[model samples]
Target chain A: GQQVMQIPQYQHVQEGEDFTTYCNSSTTLSNIQWYKQRPGGHPVFLIQLVKSGEVKKQKRLTFQFGEAKKNSSLHITATQTTDVGTYFCAGPPHRFNKFYFGSGTKLNVKP
Target chain B: EAGVAQSPRYKIIEKRQSVAFWCNPISGHATLYWYQQILGQGPKLLIQFQNNGVVDDSQLPKDRFSAERLKGVDSTLKIQPAKLEDSAVYLCASRRVRRDGNYNEQFFGPGTRLTVL
Candidate 1:
């Protein structure tokens, strides 16, 4: 079975502070996708990284895939109150049929 | 274009009872998925359908849970004789299939929150 692990199960920071969450897997992935779910809301797709050592940015958030393709990270710069939500990383392993999701990292920013 | 749609945003049922949830994916989307999300956890895939045909259902509890996607446009998930531990939010998502036969960028619906008492 394939498994993905996320670090810092929960994080709380000041509105102006920064936050980062890491996603790691024991097996390499063909592609990785990021999602955010607000309290009482459904999960929303954030981004997807497929190539090794790939990096993508969306406004204040930056996502990076490890050179080895088995790890990834999401970093938020100068978080805002609206950034409160849980972030999850998911991907399917090579030659696998189903995708696996990380436990998720909940983020809370104080005003 | 409209996003995925799910009915009965919330539900409450007693143990051993039965419940069902419905979902309609966006038009032209060929892949649909059902996931279970417990409080404080990520969504876990229960089943996946590719155009009315099941692609994966290894995680589904076939004895107590059953799902169907008739005509490849709408889907329904049913739970029979539910238990307390079955309480969770069921989410439905859909993705567009590319010409290369790859699917990406899943869009999720609001989800149905079920409480088993």
Candidate 2:
């Protein structure tokens, strides 16, 4: 079975600070996706990284995929109050139909 | 376009009771998934359906949990003789078919929060 390990189970930062969460999988993944879940809300798809050593950005957030295709990271620059939520990394193993999710990194930004 | 739909946003039941949750995915989406999220934890895949047939349910507890998607449109998840540990939020998600074989975008419904005492 494939599994993903996420670092910094919890993160607390000032409103203008930065935050990052790392995800490492036990097996190589075809692609990886990131999701955000707000308090008392359902998880929402954020972005996906495919290709080795790929990097993508959305406004102040950046996502990166390791060259090995088994690790990923999400970094938020100058985080704001709205950035407070749990971030999850997920993906399916090669040649598998099911997707496995990381334990998640909860972020709390103080305004 | 309408997003995924779920019923009874919240549920409370005693241990040993049975409870069911319903989900209606987005129109024309070919993939639907059910996930369980405990307090302070990320969502775990419980079952996944490709159209009306199950794609995978390896993480589901067969002794008490079961799910079905009839007519390939609507789905339901049932838990019989629920235990206190069954307390969690059940989320339903759907994704449109991609010709490129990449399923990276998924729309989620407001999950059903279950509390078993």
The DockQ figures for the candidates are 0.88, 0.89
lDDT of each: 0.94, 0.94
Classify candidate 1 by CAPRI docking class: high
Q: What is the lDDT of residue A44 in candidate 2?
A: 91
Q: Candidate 1: deviation at residue B111, Å?
A: 0.4
lDDT of 1: 0.94
Candidate 2: pairs in clash: none
lDDT of 2 at B53: 97
Candidate 1 wrong stretches, greater than 4 Å? none
What would the per-residue lDDT of candidate 1 be over residues B5-116, giving only the tens digit for each residue? Answer: 9989999999999999999999999999999999988899999999999999999999999999999999999999899999999999999888974448999999999999
Residue runs of model 2 more than 4 Å from their true location after superposition: none
